[model samples]
Target: MRATLIEVAPRDGFQPIAPFIPTNEKVAFVEAAHAAGLRRIEIGSFVNPKAVPQLRDTAEVLRRTAGLEGLDAQVLVPNARGVALALEAGARHIAYVVSASEAHNRSNVRRDVASSIAEYGEIVSGLPAGVRLRLNLATSFDCPFDGRMAEGLVLSRLEALLAHHEDVEVGLCDTTGRADPDHVFSLASACLARFGEWTRWVFHGHDTYGLGLANVAAAWRAGITAFDAAFGGLGGCPFAPGATGNVATEDVAWMFARMGVNTGVDLDALVRLAARAASLPGAAPGGRVRAALLGACATT
Candidate 1:
């Protein structure tokens, strides 16, 4: 099996941290991700600077990586203003988020389900040519406030989004890590059965309960080919309580490589990059392969 892993450390990993990472260091991390064979990366978000201070320099970070060959940068946009900023930064890939839980969506984006879907319709209709927009269904499996979500409810939301745009890219986020392997597989299968094979689906899972890798396997088994992972497993949602970092990029890469699946990522380089990410302030690397390889190097 082959899959494409989208690095989300720069954006999702660092959002909840207090100390700000230097812009140069952020760019270096992105460069290292490219070197590790990650062609697609979520570098930063275009939300209000005051809300996510760590990503205030999103434009600068995007600017620094503009010339990297074969690298595609995707930035999260919360609204029309965010869309404007991302466009100004020359970003070609833009992702808009809407939680499956109505309460969660209201809290995260300050809009109800109806309003949020309206906003998505506006963004998709007004987007310039050659730019791609992705809709992320946060809390697809479960919500902190609403508990477990039914797969049918998630599909309904996707249907609403698809009503406005055709052939859209959608990411199913296990927001607080509440989803088990069975839940992940069932939801993924349900979504695919209803949406057909042409709908591009990406799985984003958190490691809050240590089931991130297990959930990833379930999603893969259900025919999902794209995944989102943060370097070192550094990620957390500000709106969701007890939410932890995403499944580590190196961890997922290591698992796939050992399973005889090709991910096109160099494990050695990813391990080195994970080390650097772990050294960053407020960042932790949760991937076992990185620690094991570092330990091996120290003993020799």
Candidate 2:
């Protein structure tokens, strides 16, 4: 089966940067991702403008790219209010993040695990039917403040969320880049065993330790087909210390191509897009493929 790679750079990558990417530039970024054959792209978050000024123009950005062909626009929502705003802005796919680590969850959203779950439940109940919900279990592999996560604890959180909302899809996120291939497979296997054929899980990893691709491969073997990657490896958890950018979209595309799995992304076009992102202030291409492609083009 073909895999899905969701491009989260316009939201996740630009969130931690100091300066706001102009709204037009943000739209251009989305257009580039769409042109490169990415069907799903996270345009921005619908949170407090003061909290994350970079994404304040999410509505405008979404408005600009709303009617693109074969494009699915996703936006992150922190609460019911955010979800309301996202829907008002015509967002069809919405994502919510809750950390598996209690300390990290409290730090990220100012809510304890139980409280966040309750709030998320309320948010889900209030959503209008037909809106796709994506729940990210952040800090799934390890917590910067809490160290490694117990597999049982992760499974328990998953069970708790599923209990409240059975229709939701979940993403296992390595929020602090602490996941290795072995640990990733073990946790994925545990989740698979307990959930038994619930395939709506996505692997979201950061490359802080340079093990992003390895962990991705492990998850793929564990039967995960959906992934969250950023252009140029440009993302980090603003609340999670020591976190780095996500696995580069182009890099993953290259790896999957070699492995005979199709991602439907144009590797060469993605490299060009990454190069455009690297030109923006406070941005840099952290993935290897863009550099490699540049070198190859230079020699040719």
Candidate 3:
């Protein structure tokens, strides 16, 4: 089966926590992930230090991992400045996040989603030779302030972004972990039917409901393959309260491995990476392999 795994442990995994994750340690995590055969990583993010102190040294983190072999590093860009910072830091690929909810977008970025989308287009306009871009439409499954998101609404916004973007990938986010298997199948099916040709369809599912793996299977069944997972399930949304972990990278790899799909990722090495991941300052340790590895270390 065709499958591509985008690791988000570095950026999404450490950002929501309280303490500072040393840049060296972050670099180690990235290095270890590469050894485990993970090629694509959302390595860091460009945002205000005051907002996400854990990733305050984004520039340093990216610089530290500048020469890793067999790894593709990416970061989350909130706007044009973030994009510029990413470009300056030698990132060839970046992911832009704009919440699907207007209120969430304003509360998070001080602008509505439309404004952010336009800004993403502007960021694209000024792109250099080889850098690539992907946009994450967060809250695609559901929104907090706004209840029950309509599929039509998500597609409409998606259509708008696609109209403006020619070479961008779109990752539909299950921000709060409220999505189920049926939901994933329907959404992925519709998304592939409509946008698969023009853009790559990536899914960001959370383990909040213990269905993150199940949802991944749903997307796979729907003929969608690209996914974003956290190292040992490291990250969570800062805006969504009670939302704790992303699907663990090791767990997802294991799942696909057993199903005869190729993720080009090594589960045991990734499980070892989970040990270092759990040590990241204030990291909540939500993924299964991460907790298990750390627990074993404690028992030993």
Candidate 4:
């Protein structure tokens, strides 16, 4: 089976660190991701620099990456204003995040459920032609503030969002790393049932409790071919405190390669880039299988 892994190492992974990474390093990260066969990447966000200090250089990063052939540059926009900035910076793809939990959503965007939906609609209305918008429904798995929310709630929320726009891709985020394989399969089945076939659903898994790979496999089995993973397992939700980084691109690459699954990613190259991110101040290097296989631990 073929799966597309949108590497979030540069954006999501690097967003919550200290000694802010320079723009050059961010550029290098995107370049290395491309070298590793990652054609889609969330490079940065267009929020207030004070809100997310890590992405203050977003415009410069997107500008430097706009000219890269064959690589799709996507940036996160919190609202219509940020969307405009992304288009000006040459980002052909933009993503907006909304959480299932009202508490998490409010904390992240200061908007309650209905208002968040309105904002999502407003953002959708202002998109430019050819610019893909991905609406990430965070906490599709579990919310840190609410805890173990039912699939019905998540499905209902997703349906409501899809009711606003039919063409946009929906991201099912396993925020707080609370997904099990069974959980993913059931939730994905519900999504397919509610949203129908035309809507694209991408699974975004976190590794807080280390079932990320299994959950990815489950979702893939449940008809989720598009997924979001981070290079070197970098990034956590800034609003979801204590949540871990995303599943590693290298780790996912390794998992899929052996399964005869084509992720179009080079595992070794991702490992190198991950090492670079890990070396940065306050960056955490994750992906156990990646570290073991590529580092001193791989016996093979």
Candidate 5:
């Protein structure tokens, strides 16, 4: 069987860094990811500059990387205004995020969960032709502020969001990186069993507790084909205290390759790109495969 890996280092990985990455550098990374065999990438986000100055040039990055052949350049957006900005910048794929936990939702987006869901409906209703929508349900498994999310609560929230539009893709996010493999498997299994036909499901996880890859494996066992990972595991939610970087793209690719699953990612080239990402100024990059691969290369 094959799995689809979506590279999100440019947006999710870069968003937490305090220093600004040049627009050209961001675009260049997106281009390099494409060359490295990543067909889908979350390149940047459209949010208030004051809140996330690191991604202030997302629009420009979108415009610059728009022509990469076969690249599905996706951008993260928070609300209707963000969707508008992304659309204006020529973004056809937009990911709108809303935390499932009420407290985390307020902290992340300054709104309640219901409000965000309402806005999602509004965004879907006004979406133009040729545009694609992806809903990222942050804190789906665990939240820094709310602790582990209940399975029932998650299912209810997912139902509400999917009711807005079933054609969209949905991602279950472990925003705080605190989910266990059992918890991940349980929730993922439940979700797939209940809503498998409504929309496509993607798993987004972090490596903070060292269970990132384990959770990914569990999700895959539950039939989740698509996943979101960052090169060098560079990412964290600014609002989710104690949260860390995502599961490393190279790690996921390596695991899948060993499992005889076709991920279509070139691990050697991905490691090279990850090394560059790890060395970024003020970036908190995590992951073990990059170092392991480098050591192997040096000893050889």
Candidate 6:
């Protein structure tokens, strides 16, 4: 089995940290991720600095790392302004995020779900030639404010978003990390069946409940070929109380390796990078592979 693991440590992983990570360090991490055979990476987001001060220097980071060979550097854009800033920074791949739950959407972007969908249309119409778009339905399975999202609501929102554009990638995000494996599998299966041919599918999960990897496996069984993970599991949604970091990239790579699946990531190199990320001051890191690997070496 072959899978594509889109590294999100630079963007999702670093976003929640209170202290600003130096721009140079952010570029280095992206370079290291490329060296480790990760072709796609979410380097950062172009959002209001006041909202996410951690990613305020996204333009500079994007400029510095966008030229890395074979690197499909992606940036998150929440609105037309974000899209403008990202494109100004020479980003060709943009991930637009909107929550499935109305309440969560309001908290996340200060807009209702319908308003976001309208904005999605405007964004698609305004994107320049050759730019790629990836739609991330945050809270697709569960919402921090609304609790477990009804499958119908998720499907309807997805259908509405896809109606705007078809040539794009879609991510069903477990924003609060409270989603179960059964929910992940069922939703993934449903989305794939309904809109499988319309766009590419990706799974974004978190380890808050110790079900991150289990949820990943469940998505894979439902035929999801691509996933999003943060190295050392450094992430959390500021708006989602009690949510933890994303599923660790190293852990995902380890799990795939053991299952005879090829993720094309150099585990040793990834572990080294994860260690550096975990050591960052003020970073709340999670995940077991790094510690488990260190322990195994200690015993030997």
Q: Provide TM-scores for the models.
A: 0.97, 0.97, 0.94, 0.96, 0.99, 0.98
Error of 3 at 291 (Å): 5.8
lDDT per model vs. reference: 0.91, 0.89, 0.83, 0.85, 0.93, 0.93
Clashing pairs in 6: none
Tens digits of per-residue lDDT for model 2, 155-221: 9998888887776678999999889999999998787777745437889989998999999999999
Over 4 Å off, model 3: 289-300
Give the 10-residue window scoring lowest on summed lDDT in candidate 1.
Answer: 281-290
lDDT of 1 by residue, 120-147 (tens): 9999889999998898999999999999
Candidate 6 per-residue C-alpha lDDT over 1-300 given as tens digits, one digit per residue, 9 for 90 to 100: 799999998989999999889999999999999998999999999989998999999889888886789889999988888999888889999999999999999999999899999999999998899999999999998898889999999999998999989878999999999989999999999999988486999999999999999999999999999999999999999888899999999999999999999999999999989999999999989999999997898899
lDDT, candidate 3, residue 97? 88
Lowest summed lDDT across 10 adjacent residues in model 4 is found at 291-300
Ranking 2 against 4 by lDDT, winner: 2
Global lDDT for candidate 6?
A: 0.93
lDDT of 3 at 67: 86
Off by over 4 Å in 5: none
Q: Which residue pairs in candidate 3 collide?
A: 233-248
Between prediction 3 and prediction 4, the one with superior TM-score is: 4
lDDT of 5 at 286: 91
TM-score of 3: 0.94
Q: How many backbone clashes does candidate 1 have?
A: 1
